[model samples]
Target: MDSDELSEKQNRGVAARIREELARRRVSRQYLADLAKISLSTLEKALSGHRPFTLATTIRLEEALAMRLRVSETLDNVAAISNGHADEQFGAYSRASVAWIEGLYLTVRPSFGDRQAIFAYCTEIHWNEAASNLRFNEKDRLDAAFTQQGTVSIPNLSGHIYLSTNTSGQQRLIIVSRPSITGEMYGILTTLQAGRGAQLTPVAAPIVLIPMKALADAPLGRINPDQPGFDAYAAYLKRTVEEPFAMFLPGVAAP
Candidate 1:
């Protein structure tokens, strides 16, 4: 495809994703533009995918909205379509289902609990029986661990991570937007109450594999957890986590 066609396709995909996210949050275009610190026209272009969001633009939006912002390079390449891996392309048609499911999770799941939301990750993308009955007190455990050890650094960035949940009561939903390489920065929930862990199930959203150690650093103040530094994290993903993961936990598979 020509440059115009490629840009058009990417723009359409990004626009769809942004619109869905905005609708989920019930925010308007002008509000988003203001938060992103961009002119309305610029915001429109970025959403349209004619302009891939620069690191600064994304950071501004994340802070203004107080929501997670992420970009998966594995999912960003527009060439994937012409290369015939259309399923992996960055377009509305390619990600429609995943975005819809994620939108649902973002909107519907928040009402289920009041615990501090934490986004946790596993070495593998899929869950195994060993972790099936596992009760994770995401923030509580991570906080305690951090207090004692300083901070944990996660090494992976694009393979798999998860939210904390329970059976009787739901803890906060840890939404892992991106993985940290040397810091503990993550999108965190406001409050964390003692609650039950959600049973492991099919992930409704795209999973970004992250290293466990990086997560430790962000919460412990070793790095700036703000959205502006996300590109640094993304850089980690491109260099490290996109491929060459360690051994898989037994019985785990990509869902």
Candidate 2:
């Protein structure tokens, strides 16, 4: 079937399951509407099958119901390197391609002013072996883990940890440590300022994985972006990303 038809079918499935769960528990729709932080009318429409679920909305619904609506198999499949692609160029395919980052980390970045550490947030990482991907469920699962006391738990909100090879044959891992995207402005500021944007161009800094003991340690408090530890961490990450054969080596660390 086409994309639209598939989406509609998924929506119907989600709506049916949500309604069934609610009915089984004998709870009011308003209870979940409030939990999901969506309006009554909006929740009504979604529950009544008038709207399709976006990824963001699906996450919110998962949080509200304490269950994954429908974990698609597509989310876990990694595209194979094209046939005849040089192993040196594409890197060897392995079940361990993205498993080393499986743990908790406090993602940090420097802000424009004072170079103060922006405590982007604590993100938990895990391997989605089925999908051959890294799972970072910082925003959804960790916060809700302790809440509701008895809510049902699912595997995780797993998605692909994007990676691509550059012309130099270096592998770059793109990480979105922030829960929300920030930093965008339009013409008035950009036109007046030297380094600002004249038109809307949104950009957010991403976390680059470097082999840091602290990243694995996940110290109790927020990480300082300017600290020597973080400095070494960032440097190691950038340097490694530029290396030609670092990751493919056996027994090497993951980022």
Candidate 3:
């Protein structure tokens, strides 16, 4: 097939897959448009077959859906259709390694009851390019047995990031999200503790967000726990913030 025909076929496949995925996941057009960084009208047109997806648009879609729309596997040779000549716009992709996702995030998860949030210093991130998945570890656990290890899988049925751990015969699942405008990674924390319930369902609560380092050697100092995880946060806060974290603990009243 000619290059034009190949491109058109790929575009159609992309549109179809997008429609299928949206329908299966019951995702809103506006939500996807916002996540894909595209206008609602443009996303509607592309999904409805009124317009083909541009390379940039396709990249955004891939990131949002965690699925590839094109079978080329490499964006190196994708040139503009004009004059059937290679374009310089895609020359940057020839070097590869552009699709890698890696970073460290100071995460927080909810503690049981009404206790304050647990601040996890996420310092290690492992992203496997070939496997298309990632894992991270948080080392700020006050107790050695309570350390957290996280894994981020490719999106399929859900768009949420989940961090799970199985230790001491207990299972915990923390549904997380990407960084916010304020650079905080916040989400819901849930656990499957049979002692807490009889239905085998997960109990969930909103987590806390404490950025480890917002500035160079500057402190985010967001962890102000009340009872449960306050000790660990105070330990972290003492070294990270300008003020002592003891002031934020149970007896100390952070104001």
lDDT on C-alpha atoms for all candidate structures? 0.35, 0.41, 0.50
Overall local distance difference test of candidate 3 = 0.50
Better of 2 and 3 by TM-score: 3
Off by over 4 Å in 2: 1-9, 12-97, 118-120, 127-137, 140-255
| Candidate 2 or 1, higher lDDT | 2
State the lDDT of candidate 2 residue by residue for 106-178, as single tens digits: 5433332234443333445443322233333332222232112111011224232332212122122332221
Residue 70 deviation, candidate 3, in Å?
31
What TM-scores do the predictions have? 0.26, 0.33, 0.37
Displacement of residue 141 (Cα, Å) in model 2 is 14
Kindly list the per-residue Cα lDDT of model 1 for residues 48-70, writing each as its tens digit: 55566665665565444333244
lDDT winner: 3
| Top candidate when judged by TM-score against the true structure | 3
Give the Å shift of residue 68 in candidate 2.
13
- Tens-digit lDDT track of model 3 for 1-255: 333332666777677667765654455788668766789998888777677778778777766654445655343323322223212422212212322324555554443333454444444444422223344455544443334553454343454455655443355776545445665444566665334455565666555344555523322223455444557554433432233211223455535
Looking at candidate 1, what is the lDDT of residue 140?
Answer: 20
